[model samples]
Target: MSNAEMILELVRKNNGVVTAAEVTQAGISRGSLNHLVNSGLLEHASRDVYQLAEVWDNEMYQLQIRYKKGIFSGKTALFLNDLTDRTPIRFHMTFPLKYNIGVLKKQNVKCNRTKP
Candidate 1:
């Protein structure tokens, strides 16, 4: 397959989303991403993130794609692990101590100091 075709296939595999890293790792030129965006085939979801034009913005997707190191913890974990019936109103995220958590804090997400 051609470069654009390869890129599109990758996007499809990622549920209509793909990152520059994934693109490069797939042996496709990262620069080709701009071509796709300029030609209206894809749109920017975030820095270095792209998604199909028809795909709606997904919050969970954005979280997972943007923050690969972030983990769901605290009340969210309890609910997920079936330890509590109450739904978690907040998502406790644990990342490296040096990781900038300003963005998460801005969203009202609590940051854990250490990993479990």
Candidate 2:
């Protein structure tokens, strides 16, 4: 499949958001992404992340992508494990204490980075 088509397929399979690293590894260039955005095919939803314009279920995708750098935890982990009936208004994740960079501190999400 073509690069654009492959990118779209990955977005669809992953819900919506696809990592910039993944796109780069797939041989897609920044110019190509800009072209897609200009064509209204993709939208930049966060730093180093893009989502398909036609996809609607983006919350899960965003959560999963955010958790990609850490482990799902607290209410978020409970939700991920299907132990909760309510959806969290904020995302929660945990990483190694040494890797703690407070990336999600300002966002609605909660992050805990402690020694595992």
Candidate 3:
């Protein structure tokens, strides 16, 4: 199959989201990604992340993608795990003690550090 086809298949298998890293790892060129995005076949969900155009924007998913090491915590975890009905006003994520939270602090995220 073509590079564009491979990228689309990757997005489909990943629940409508795929990353540029994944594409590169699969031996697909970044130009293919640009081509797909330019053709309206894909949408940029966040830096290095892409999703099918038909998929609805999911903030939690996008954040999770951008912060792979972050774990949803507190109200965000409760809501995601279906332990609470209330939606979180600010999403919370916990990371390793040494993980940098500088960038997360700029977003609408309540960043926490895990205890050793």
Candidate 4:
């Protein structure tokens, strides 16, 4: 199969989402991601994540992809883990004690830090 085909296959396997890091790990070049985006087959979802153009924007998934170090917590975790039926008004995430939270706060995420 062609490079584009391989990339599309990867996206399909990933529930219509894929990341540049994943592509590189699969031995694919980032150019394939750009090509797919240019062709309108995929849309940039975040800094390094892409999704099928037709897929609805999953905010939680996108945030998780964008901040790999941020772990869902509190009400957000309850909703994500199916422990609650109500959606959280704000996303809650926890990062390491020393991790920078400026960017996460800019995204409107409720940032929490682990105890050192």
Best by TM-score: 3
* Candidate 3 residue-wise lDDT, 1-114, digit = tens: 999999999999999999899999999998999999999999988899999999999989889888889999999999988999999999999999999999888889999998
TM-score of 2: 0.77
Give lDDT per model, in order.
Answer: 0.84, 0.75, 0.92, 0.90
- In the range 9-32, model 4's lDDT, one tens digit per residue, is 999999999999999998999999
Cα distance off (Å), candidate 3, residue 71: 0.6
Q: Pick the candidate with the highest lDDT.
A: 3
Question: What TM-score do all the candidates reach, one by one?
Answer: 0.75, 0.77, 0.93, 0.89
Give model 4 RMSD, 1 decimal.
Answer: 1.5
Model 4 ranges with Cα > 4 A deviation: none
Report residue 23 deviation for candidate 1 (angstroms).
0.4
lDDT of 1 by residue, 6-93 (tens): 9999999988999999999988898899999999999988878999999999665577677888887788778779999997676777
- Per-residue lDDT tens digits for candidate 2, residues 1-116, read 77788888877887677877888887887666677778899997777778888766466566567556676779987987899998988877777888755656877767778887
What ranges in model 1 sit over 4 Å off? 75-91, 106-108
Point out the higher-scoring one by lDDT: 1 or 3: 3
